[model samples]
Target chain A: MAVLFGGVACLALAGGVGVIASRRPVHSVLALLLVLGSLAVDYLLLDAQFIAVLQLIIYAGAIVVLFVFVIMLLHARSGEVARVPAVLPPAAAIPVCAVFGLMLLVVLTGAAIAPAAVGPAFGTVQEVGRALFSRFLLPFEAASIVLLIGMIGAVVLGKRLPPSPPDAGRPAEGPGEGRSKRRVELR
Target chain B: MSTADLVLVGPELVLTIAAVVVLLQDAWATGGVLEPQTPRPAAVWGSLAAVGLALVWDVGGRRWGPAFGGMYVRDQFTMIADLAALAAAGLGILLSSAYLPRVRLPAGEYHALLLLATVGAMVMAASGSLITLFLGLEILSFSLYVLAAIARRSRRSLEAGLKYLLLGAFATAFFAYGIALIFGATGSIDLREIGAARPSRLLGAGIALLTVGLAFEGALVPFHAWAPDVYEGAPLPVTAFMSVVAKVGAFAGLLRVFPLALAHLAGVWGPMLAAIAVVTMILGNLAALFQTNLKRLLAYSGIAHAGYLMIGVAAGGPAGTWSVLFYLLVYVAMNLGAFGVLLLLARQGMEADRVEDLAGLSGRAPWAAAALVLFLVSLAGLPLTAGFIAKLYLFRAALGAHQPVPALVGVLTSVVSVYYYLRVASAALSGGAPQAVAVLRNRLVGAALVLATAGVLWLGLFPAGFTAAVQQAARQAAAAVR
Candidate 1:
């Protein structure tokens, strides 16, 4: 079981790196989706089914969709100025790979020892609901507040502007209208 | 669940109700009625009521208790922190009362978002477990993403919002993974359970990853890149909200997790934090010297302050926790006052955040200049200001824990920081002719300055009373983790 989980983690990490490195925006989004999905699977294997589902729903489905939509809206296609110039790519790649290598090394060397037993934990929907509403009530309330604020912001941003101050009740004046009218009368 | 628990959450409930009402009002009052041109006093009043209720709940709930099983806990710490956040939001609203009319942002949604974000910060301060922590973080982050870009017409605001959102989401991913791994190791998501569990290699790695993620959210070290850009890009009041309230929430969460959940792996995480602290302080201060943009400079200043706060985290005992809590209190006042001044100084489309723009401020707006000087001096950790007492308490805490290295580094950094703080103050008092620039003198703005300045001075002068309060909060905070 430990070995299998390790394999899954490895796969997720590799996929995540690939996604981050990919030049194609669509491909990158798909890769991110895979990473999130794979992580959910890993979470389930770790006996956190609820969080797994959340990862899938919130990250893979919602966030990724937002990313794709925004990318499309902006028309930021891949392969157009996709890759950085020579100086920057190597500079970026080297440190990234080093960090990746270090993380992998830490995982490989670190103890992956399986615990003696896995309990019949609160891995079910009912248990999660109980946990969320009871012990996690403050955060639950906070989440509601967050959603409320997001809605309010959407409304505020979406609201159309009011017309300009009723034109301050001033008579319409064209460019140099007053001076021109006086000059015309004198003429 | 006691009736008191319900009361403890009363402020949030009120805010929640107001949010719904505002949403309904928006739904009905479409186009012109709810538009920026038509300012709705009713909506504004509703938001004020919500803020008032949140404050009432914050003050009303003085004791600690578990709610919803053990997922959420409320205590003096939560109350104090929530009060701080609510106060900042309230002042932000007051600042915006005048600022919005001048900038043409007469929409009520601004107040609603501000209240909602405060709610998130409150939850974050009170969270007891990983699940609760993540939820609170998301609540804060998502709202901020929108708030950062509230001025949709400005390209800079849009760009900043996008950068913050993308980076923030990425950080969240890292955080979620850390949570998953910790669950895998302990088979429990509760912080106390994780705190009591013996350390394993997997758990240590998980702790490290979690620290990294939290540090980024806290705007610490290498992960701090987004703060300045986002702070600079966002609107003045929004920037003020983010600077103070966000830092408080993040630190609250960090104090809960690092010292409690991963206490066993301190050897692994502690040294890394200390290194990050050294680097963040040096880099943040050095970078501030070169910035011409006042907002960007404040952003760097914030980074440096984050480093100082992390020293308290490094201390990690009772003294350290209390010291951190105390510093955070001081931080809220000093930062909010600074941002309040910026809000006043900045006219529509003209960001007075540039360092040079502040020249001759002492002559133009003496009261505003005086307030700025107080805040800047406090930030510099000068004697007779809250910043000095805050740092003194922090160092005492570090020394108490026998963590001489970080304490020493902190003192050195504080010394280096004095120069930049003084530079800003000196500029505010110097060269530009008084007649040349128009000083901001809006009544609402003047009110904000008075409130912020009083808080900073009060905290600086009467730190003992505040420290006592923080001590009680620190005890509860540490206990929640344990």
Candidate 2:
């Protein structure tokens, strides 16, 4: 069990590192998808099925797909620079991960983990559901509202552009035609 | 569910309702006018009305705590901070009125989001429970995510919004993980419970992570990469609002949550915060020195100011909390006034964000130039401006707690910040070239400036009333400590 848990954690860490280090935007996004999926698996390993499912549904399925679609739509010419400039990426990323790793280490070292109870107990779907519908109801509702807002926002901001002008249907043959086409397009 | 609970949360409810109404109004205004009608400034009026209602609620009460099943609380400190946040929102609306119309961005959603964000900040300040805190933080952050990219046609705006969203979600995850740890440690999410509980290892780790999350939101160094891009990309007024009001909410949350739950673990977290404060201040100021863009410079300045405010948090005492409240109030006033000028100068469809954009501003627009001077001086912590007194008091409080390192870093950053602050001032004062046609011609904006400038000058010169109110609020916050 420990080995399984540790392997899942290692896979998550590697996936995350790949997401950060990958040179291609598409590859980085794919890596992110993996990392997010790995996180859900980790949640399952920890016995939090509800959280694992929510993680899959919300982050991995919805958000990552949206990211990929946007990346595809906003694609540059095939060989264009896909990575952010140095001092920009590392300056933002390294400290965040370092602090996260250190903090996780602290939490793990400090926490005296409860010995595994072999039966279904805490962190099960039933326990999570009970908590969600009762003690955590308010936060759950609040989160739902937040998610709703995010959905509405995405729709509003991501309005697809209308079909291009009729003039755009035809290619300009040369500079003179292009100038006339531009003028026609402006009108 | 008595009326008193509702009354205690009157300001928050009023602002929330106003946000909804404003959003509805915006939808109505722009929905039927299919041909992109001239921007009807519904956002501006709604923002003003919302702020007015918030002020009424703020002035209506000066009492404290556990008002609604321990969800919300209100006191003098919160009252003052709420007023400041609302006032900043109001100015932001006024500035955006003049600013957005030029760019032809829709205004209603913008205004509604601003009000909701303010409500979130105020709620955060009044939060007595973890549920309220989380709700308030999400409200503030989500609204900001949209507002940061209101000019969606601009690539910079889209990029800023995306970056803020990514980092913000990451920060929220950290916050949630910390909350989970704390719940595991104490079996309760109430701030009062967390405060009274002793420093178990789980709780300590929770506090550390929570601090990190809040620090990131607050834009302290090492966690502040998103700030410059977002601030520079956002509308000048929205950027100003993000810098000031959002910081108010974040600090209020930190001030209340930290001292209450983690005071016993100060040995663990205090030095961590102090180091963060130092790095944030120095990095913010040093980075600002090389910026040619006015908005980017102010973004860095905002970061430095955040570091200064963190001094009070590092102190981890009642006095420290009071000083933070006072500084936030002053900061709101000064930053709003500064952005007012930027809004004034920002020509439509032009990058009015660069330092060169301000060349000879004084010769062309004396009133705006003077307002800019006042704001710049205050930002530099010059005497007779509110920032100076706020810093003095905050440093004194930190020293009182024997945390001199943050104070020292704060002073050094303050000195370093003076150069950039004055460079902008001198740019405005140079009067070599004719300024672009000024955009801030509206009387409402003028009124905002008058009010904000008065608050800055008055708070700097005579902060007794503000400080006294803050002290009372600090007392109430500490009441939950035991």
Candidate 3:
């Protein structure tokens, strides 16, 4: 069991590196899938079958598909790398990452773990569902609200503005207005 | 889900229903596509009515205690936070009523999102568990992100939204990891249970990370890089609403976690927080001095106010908790009033955001100028205004807790803040070139200004009644934790 866990963890780590190292957007997405898939396998190995399935169905299946679709729609090419300047140059980024990695390693390694005794039904669907409806009901309801807001926000931010009526009497051409107009013309 | 639990969440339910109804009404009105130049008054009025109903439910309802299996509590702390959030929402809607149509923003989404955000803040204040707290924070942050970018026709607004979203997501990640670490250390996610658990280094680290998240939302220094630009870029009413609502939520969460939940660990986190408060107060004030934009200036001022509120949290007693609550209530008035003045001065799709925009304002519009001066002085913690009383309570709380340095820093920072606050006030009062800036003569905005000015004066002059009530509430809240 330990060997399997170790092998899957290494696979996940390798996939994670590929996710950042891949030059092509689509290839990067494929690397993300590999990472997510290995994480799901790790969850399964831990006896969290429901969560493992969810990890695959949600992150690997749906979200990755969405990412690929967006990449395709945007027609992202390998040569058309990020035109925006990097927020942190490699000189700054590398040392920052290294320090954060070191701190996390120290914190995790220094912590003493005393695993709690679990019931026979731990990680089972019934137990999870019961807890969700009873003890965690408020959080479950609140999560729905968060999801609802996400949907509303997507529509509000993404929807194309309808053409302005001639008599709208808008005084100035704002920055977003001009860009959106150009998009409409291009379409 | 018993009726009792439903009653406890009555205000949130009303606002949620109202948000959906407003969205549906907008969809029906516009035939599923946003129509440019259309002003939807129904959405605005409906949202205002919902906020009023929530306020009524929040204040008048007698049901108060742990509900939803102790996931939520409807105690005095929640009530104070709810009042601040609801007050901000009501005033925000009033401020938006005129500005929305002028800016060509869809009224339905704007009001709907604002209501939901208020619900989020209330949820955070009421949360008895970390899960509810994180969920509530997400709801609030998500709603504000879209609201910030709702002015899609403005590039600056979009940029502000993107920056806020990226940085806010990073902060949220920190917050979630902190929760995980806390659960790992304590073996429970419930606040009361965690408080009873033994403190460890892991818990300390978790608390620090949690503070980072809340401080980011509060716009405390070192985590406040996004504030000035976001405030300057977003629509005026949004800047106004978020300035108060975010602080109300963040500080309330801080109050709950530091003073109420982890009261036993005050020795661990208090001094660290005090140091943060000192730095935030000094840096926020110094930054405000250089900002020529009204929105950016107010943003820095908001950060400084967060530092003062933090003094109360670091103090960690009934005095500290209630002082923070009182300051939030007062902030709803003074901060929103300052932004409301700017909102009124906005003209034909252009924001009068510059300090120079208010030139000769006392000569042209005496009432608005006077109102602006009153809000500014109150914000500067001057005498005869709510800001002074609020700051006094915070400083007293800090000193009562025997943390003299933060209190002293707060006092000195107020002196430094006066220069910038008075600079804007002087700009409005001084006679200068005839500015083309016209104050929008909207009755709704006028009504909001009147309400805010009255609140500032009432809280300042006769702070006795409110302070007494807050004291009682604070005592009850502390009793619950103990």
Please report the candidate that would top TM-score against the real structure: 3
Question: Which lDDT tens digits does candidate 2 get at residues A54-134?
Answer: 899999999998998878766643535556542347766797678768867876787575543444766777887776775
Estimate, for each residue in A1-187, the C-alpha lDDT of model 3 and write its tens digit. 9999999999999998888777677888999999999999998887888889989999999999999988877774543544334245888689658846764775687668688777777778998999999888889989999999999999888887655533555563222232233322210
Query: Pairs clashing in candidate 2?
Result: B195-B260, B195-B261
Q: Which stretches of candidate 1 lie over 4 Å from their true place?
A: A1-90, A115-187, B1-4, B23-35, B38-44, B263-267, B432-436, B480-482
DockQ of candidate 1 against the true complex: 0.22
Residues A1-187, model 1: lDDT tens digits: 8888888888788788777677767777888887888889888887888888888899988999999997776665552434422233776679767865777687789777676574577567878888666665566666666666666667655655443432435321111111122312110
- Please give, for residues B2-35, the per-residue lDDT of candidate 1 as tens digits: 6766765676678767766765675466443432
Instruction: Note the B-chain TM-score for every model.
Output: 0.94, 0.96, 0.99
Off by over 4 Å in 2: A1-101, A111-141, A161-187, B1-4, B32-37, B435-440
TM-score of chain A of each: 0.62, 0.62, 0.79
Clashing pairs in 3: none
Model 1, residue pairs in steric clash: A134-B68, A134-B69, A135-B68, A135-B69, A135-B70, A135-B71, A135-B72, A136-B71
Which segments of candidate 3 are over 4 A away from where they belong?
A76-111, A163-169, A172-187
lDDT of each: 0.74, 0.77, 0.86
- What is the TM-score of each predicted model, taking all chains together? 0.85, 0.83, 0.95
